[model samples]
Target: MTSLIIGVLLVVGGAMVGIALDRSLLRRWIRNRDPRRHHPAPETRAASSRRRSARHAIEDAERRVESAEAGQLSAETAASRVEASLDALQAGLVLCDRNGRVVAQNTAATQFLQARHGEALVAPVIKDLLEQARSGELVTTRVELHAEPRRSYEVRAGPVERGGEMLGAVALVHDITEHDRIESVRRDFVANVSHELKTPIGALSLLADSLAADSDPEVAAHLAGRMQIEIQRVANTIDDLLTLAMLEDESGRPGARVDVGAVVAAAVDRISETAEQNDVKVVLSNRTAATAIRGSRLHLESAVFNLLDNAVKFSESGGRVDVVVEADQQALTVSVTDEGIGIPATEQSRIFERFYRVDRARSRSTGGTGLGLAIVRHVALNHGGDVSVTSREGFGAKFTVTLPLDSGD
Candidate 1:
């Protein structure tokens, strides 16, 4: 019985040691799972759940960090591309802070600002625009820059806003110099057309009334002759206007290659009567025999005839007019030289303008419509070429019309 009691006590002691060892292992597992928990204690299921939540929170934070880095890289790349695109624009673009200081400018903006206006002029103008924009007022104005070649720019400034708050102002500058020049030309042309048409129409009306009222045959004949001259002048003007309109048409066919020398000869023949009447001798030198240029035969003939007619009209009685057809590798040139009261240097640049005459009285007496040289210039330009003149005030004038040769030339 004593040996049985001792064995039973030993078995109870072994069971108690086993229970302690299990508790120690549970505390060790809790400590290993969550090292932040310093107190050694057996883990409950709630503690294990909290540890799992902490691990998930750490992993989520790492994922967000990676996502944020990617977003930052994308944003930077997008900003870089936006900046590059802005730099490529032909118009000047400038961004300013609310304080009216220049925040950013593209390469075109810098060069255009320097080339367009003086700093003294542009800086103050930009500052005022920025001030206006900062006040939430959209600003627009035209600034005329006085440079070597005068330029006109349209400036527009507006506030840049985000989330209903004004960030800064962006200003765009566009070069409108060509546009303004064209508008001015259009206005002048309208005025000139009105004046030119009125003069001939008025004369015709006066001459017609006089002829109808006159009973004397001699007086009636004189009035009729004057009326005919005025009518012819009006007709010439209309024909020239039509020719110029046709030449400027975009859909007009590329003209066929024609013998330029033959065209010159025909042009001289067409005006031979007028040359004889004016007592001016026309001398034609056709050095280039089969020289050809790309243009309409009728149009080319008209251009050459106009030049020859002008020479004959302006030349002195019995003065000589020379027509020379020459060619080079690239082009065929027809030069008309005449011994006439030549054009002044200051006036030479403007002589090609339509209805422009050096001597209005002489133009009227010679029955000139003042569109001859202008026609020649436009015709040459349309044929992929140009026309130029060299003249001195007292000396004679030489007009050169150069037409581009065909590719096979």
Candidate 2:
């Protein structure tokens, strides 16, 4: 019995140790699973749940931050593209606030501002123009800039308004120096034409009165012949003027396709008699074979005839005039070279201008209306080409007419 009791006590002690070890393991697992339980009583099961929810909320916020960063990057890229495109435009652009302060500017605007840098406090001109624009009075004025080179600009300023409230002003500038010069020249040409026409008409009128009053046969005959020549001159000038006007008008009209070779041949034929009378010969360097250009047939023929006539008139007795037609892939070049009293270098540039002559007395004696070269130039330009002259004081002159082979239109 004593041995049995000892064995039983030993078994009970082993079971108690096993139970304590199991409880210790369970506590350790609970502690590892939930570290918040180590806090005071305030951190209960509900508090643990709240902490878990807070962690999830923080993770959601982090995800939103990453998404927002991506969106910001896209917006920045779009803005950069817009800015780059705006910079590429040729027009000047400026952004200003309601107070007429320049807030933003493009490359064109910056360059324009720099050009006007010498004006009163550089900023004041812009401010004043903007202020004037805001007052409902759009200012359109021409401003001259003296930079490395002189330039004329037409500056236009207008208001930018929203809901009847003045926001700012936008200014646009155009370089019109060349345009202005052309307009000036056009005005002078009109005046010159009026004066030229008046002289012939007045002379014809005076001669007609004299012939009507005079009963002498010889005097009347002389005056009538002179009047007839003047009338013919007037008619020729009017015809040339009309031809030039038609050439300068809109294209795609009737008689647009002109056989350039035929026109040249016809001009040579028409001037054959005159060439013989002046003892001048017409020599054609036939290289084009035959090519057609888009121009008024009559005008083209007249242009060629004018060139040939001028050559024959200016050539010396028994001088040979060469007419060369050089046609290439891109352009057709018609050059009329004459061995005559060549034009001076200083007068070459203005020879093509209407009523412009190197020697007025000589041009009048030659019976030239001074519109032949001008008409030729107009025809060349209308056909998308240009006319150039190279001459020395003693050496002969070469007048080249370059016309595009193909009309891209």
Candidate 3:
């Protein structure tokens, strides 16, 4: 009985141990299928946190890549726009390194900076300005470029800096050739006006004194007539000056549409009495009936009248002055050809200048103010045309005024 009882106890003990082993194996298999069960609660929480952090890190990396791409695109667009704006500017622009070497320049820089024929646009003035800029100085200067046609430029240069660090220098160049020319013209005009007025005023004063002192009525009358002629010349000069001043104004009248033929006829009519007095024949030849140009009628008439008057005044007795009007696609041309003592080739270029006279004595005798051709030139220029002359000394002369034709004409 004792042996059987011991055997039963051993069997029961072995069965309990087998049951514990099976339970532990089953727990291990469950832990292998789902790793969360393999560790303590704190360790499982830490692993879950690590997984979340890795996923967030991947999303952040993707966002950074996207942001970088956007920034790069925006930068490229901005750079392109800046380059295009720089190219469209008319003023010359130049960029230089801190060492004063050229890095970039616009097309106008080549023209206004005197960079023709492989010459450097960074002139001595520019170099000096760059040096000053690199030293943190803002500079502005008017520098004339050494070039043909003699251009004047206003240059402005300054430092290109960021965060107190200098990158290089930049310069802007503005052409002032037209302004200089106008200023010169204004000075010359004042001087010429003063000189011309003095001549007439002095002559008038002297003649009036002589008339007052003379006892004979005949001598007084001759002196008075001479004064009248001088007074007329003075009046004409003032009128021409006023016209030129009006033309120079920016708000001046553009002009009116007028028939070239009618202007020629009126001009000829105005000079008829003078022509007869000089014994010069005046003939009008119209090659085109439809010669039309847009311009001030009074100015046009004055131009033609001056030409005819000049021709008649210079012509010898019985010489013929022919007014020929012709037209082509580009222009309506009125040419006044005269048989007169012609202008020398050397003097021809300067004859159109205000107050310039080739033969001062002859001009005085004929009461020429020396501003007729000058007036004609300005009138033609205002009308979008020009005046040119062809002459051979002692042979004859032709003064041609060309006005641009209206599109329909």
Candidate 4:
């Protein structure tokens, strides 16, 4: 019985040892199969690091793309704004590269250069100026173009430098035609004034010498009368000149409300004596008596009086002078017509010029100042009105003054 019990104990111990070894092997296999093990493999760690690095690179590339698009948009906006500003300038502007090639030009530049082959004429001047300007100097040239309008152009150019380095050149073009025209007018006016004043002074000197030498009472009386006439002529001429100078100023214009009908009537009353002496009959037609306009009453009276005086002086004896006052929504017109020798077509345009006379002999005989028409023209212009004449030689003449209607009315 003892021997069998020993044998049984030994077999049981062997089976228990085998079962423990199998359980340990199953635990190791479970740990190896699970990827969440405490210690990961080297290859798994390396793969995880690579995936993270690739994801970060893609995010950086996306950010760069967005930034690049934004930069491009900003640059385009800035370029468009620069172009607009350059085009807005009134003076002609041309920008050239370092090689003197035209890189940019404004609308005014195109118009100025293309006006009647102006480009062909001015291109050579521009090239020369740019070449000179490359020496870091401001260069200028003026070209006189004898085109239909006879214009003059001045081109001024200079090198454009940044940080002491010349980059290119910029040019400005100006139209100086009007400036030259004004200078010419000034010269002519000075010459005309000198000649006009010298004539009366020479006559006065001759008449004075004759009066002093004469002894007979009848001859002395005649000489004295002639001297008085010349003196009066000089006085009249001086007065007209003074008036012209005053009229050039803004203060000489109309500054108050005036009645068209009353102004016309007053003018007629002032020239009544002169009209009688000339044996001319003046008939007044007051159609716009109720109309009112803004201007100086004194100036209006003077303007109307001069017009009427001009008509009566030019009319033949028994000839009638017609003065009509009419108005519309836009303007008021005062027309003076005379049954007199009409102005020649060729001479009519120059009638309003100061000291201009169509018939010098007639003007001298009638004691008329040649400045009458000029005064009329100035008055009309100062009052924001215009004066016009219509006539045929030897038939009749009509002077019409059109004054703008006040906007406040």
Comparing 1 and 3 on TM-score, the stronger one: 1
Q: What is the lDDT of residue 323 in candidate 4?
A: 95
lDDT of each prediction vs. the true structure? 0.82, 0.78, 0.83, 0.81
Query: Compared with the true structure, what per-residue lDDT tens digits does model 1 show for residues 136-201?
Result: 989999888786457787878899888998888988878888898778767867776786778889
Instruction: Report, for all candidates in order, the number of backbone clashes.
Output: 0, 0, 0, 2
Q: What is the lDDT of residue 264 in candidate 4?
A: 89
State the lDDT of candidate 3 residue by residue for 1-409, as single tens digits: 2221111123464574222334555666777899556655997789989999999999999999999999999999998888788888888888998787889877777554575442344466667787888888899888665765466777788999989888999988777778887787668767878977888999999998998899799999899899998889899889888876676563433556688799899999999999999999999999997777667888889899989989999999999999999988778899999999999988897788887777878987898877888888888888888999999999889999988886434
Tell me which residue pairs clash in candidate 1: none
Q: Is candidate 3 or candidate 4 better by lDDT?
A: 3
**Model 1 regions lying over 4 Å from their true place:** 1-73, 115-120, 145-147, 162-164, 250-255, 339-341, 344-350
Candidate 4's error at 183, in angstroms?
Answer: 2.2
- Candidate 3 stretches with Cα past 4 Å from truth are 1-48, 80-89, 111-122, 132-148, 154-172, 245-258, 276-281, 292-296, 314-320, 329-331, 339-365, 381-397, 404-409
Output the worst ten-in-a-row residue range by lDDT, candidate 3: 1-10
Q: How do the predictions measure up, each by TM-score?
A: 0.76, 0.67, 0.73, 0.69
Name the lDDT value of residue 397 in candidate 1. Answer: 99
Model 1 TM: 0.76
How far out, in Å, is residue 34 in model 2? 15
